[model samples]
Target: MRIGVLGTGGMAAALGGAWARAGHEVFVGGRDGAAAEALARRIGGAGHGTPARAAEYGEVALLAVPAGAAPALAEEHAAALAGRTVVDCTNPLAPGPDGVMLTTRAGESVAGRIQAAAPGAHVVKAFNLVHASVWDLPAGAFGETPPAVPFCADDAHAAERVAGLITAMGWSPMPAGGLDRAVYVEATAAFVIGVWWAGGSPRLAFPEPAHPSA
Candidate 1:
């Protein structure tokens, strides 16, 4: 798959590296072209001038920028993203006295906003519940083995594609449901954040389901 990643952050770099390692063609784009190029070099992928260029280069695009920046990025790359599958990997986190706060409403989410802005694009929510660090860990980085990462999307094909990509990175993929299910996914992210803060470790991941007895 020719994948494009918009955002020069840790999450973007992590996913880009995973895809590149999985033998997928990946192009990374950011506000700083140089930084994006550097990341691509580190990740063994390609880099682009802007978000639009990255979107244009990819059959599928991953929007891994800040939740606040998601809508603007979608609008800026609307032309490029038209008729393409877009995987959303952002969390609407707001600064608060205690900790980060979720900025999305009960009915709305960042993925929904991106879909609304780029109506022609197939926007799917994913990668919002895990930390970037988890993506780089070796297989069995956790205890006995690695666990599945849960994600959701409205578009079944897009969801399957992203889920396959996730599995290629040496982790299992658990599909939670459609786009509206993003609310639960984002809330789970907040819960994960709390658990990390309390435990002081980011290496932990959610456990996968056990097989049922016959």
Candidate 2:
């Protein structure tokens, strides 16, 4: 698989490095050409270039930029991104006096906006729940069991492709319905961020909500 990473940030480096280690070709792109090239070398990427070039180089592209910048980046490379699977790992959250605040409007997720920006691309919301440091761990990152990552996508094929990538990177893919449900995933990220900020464990909050009676 050829993967393109559209940022030089932590998330971008983590995922790109994992995929590269899995024997997939990768390209790291960023606004700063030098930073992109440095990240590419660090991650064993096949190449490095501008975001547009990254979009053109891969069958699967990961948008790990800031949430506010995702739309413009997507729009700028819409032509190259068309007909490709685009994975969104952005969380629209900022630290506030109270806790983390969601930057997106009600009912609108960063992934959704990115989809609108590049209407022809298959936008899948994923890799937003966990911290980038977690992705740096080996196959069994979470002690005995690998963590499950919930993703939402309107395109079944694209979803499956992204799921495969997630699995390759050592995570269990939990499909959270279609793209319409993506806002929920984004909200989950916000909630999780708040929990971390408050020094609480988000994992403890997620259990079998209710077990069915046998």
Candidate 3:
């Protein structure tokens, strides 16, 4: 798969590296062309000038930028992303002295906002629950087993493709249903953030259920 990662941050680096390792073509883009090139060099992928170019070059475009920047970015790449699957990995994180709060409402989600901006794109909400460190580890780093990463999207085919990509990254993919369910998933991100605050650990993961015997 040709994947375009739009961000030069830790999460973008982690995921882009993993996808490159998995034999996929990846193009990373950012505001600064030099920084994007540096990130691509580090991840062994190509780098592009603008988000629109990256979106045009990829079969699936992963938006790993800050959540607040999503709408504008989506709008910028709307034409390029037409009829494409866009995997949204952003969380509506509102930061302040008090800490981070959910910027999205109880019934709305970042994925939906991006979808609204690019109505032609199939937006799937995922990878927001896990830490960037988890994506940096090897496939067997979590022992012989690993945890599940839950996601949701309105389009079934797009969701399935994204799920396969998620599995290839050494994590189990738990489909949490339609895109509307992203509201709950975003809420869960807040829940996970709370847990991290209380436990003082940002490396925790949600356990996957074992398969039943046939």
Best by TM-score: 2
TM-score of 2: 0.95
Clashing residue pair totals per candidate (backbone < 3 A): 0, 0, 0
What RMSD, rounded to one decimal, does every model reach?
Answer: 2.9, 1.5, 3.1
Quality of model 3 by C-alpha lDDT: 0.84
Q: Give lDDT tens digits, candidate 2, residues 50-150.
A: 98889988789999899999989999999999999999999999887788888889998989999999999999999899889888889985777777889
- TM-score, per-candidate, Cα-based: 0.88, 0.95, 0.89
The order by descending TM-score is: 2, 3, 1
lDDT of each: 0.82, 0.90, 0.84
Q: Who is ahead in TM-score, 1 or 3?
A: 3
Better of 2 and 3 by TM-score: 2
Per-residue CA lDDT of model 3 for 1-214, tens digit only, reads 9998888898889888999998888998888888888898998746666666788987899998989898789988899988889988888876546666788776888888899999999999998887888788888787877777889988888988898898898888899998889888887887677667666554546444596563
Which one is best on lDDT? 2
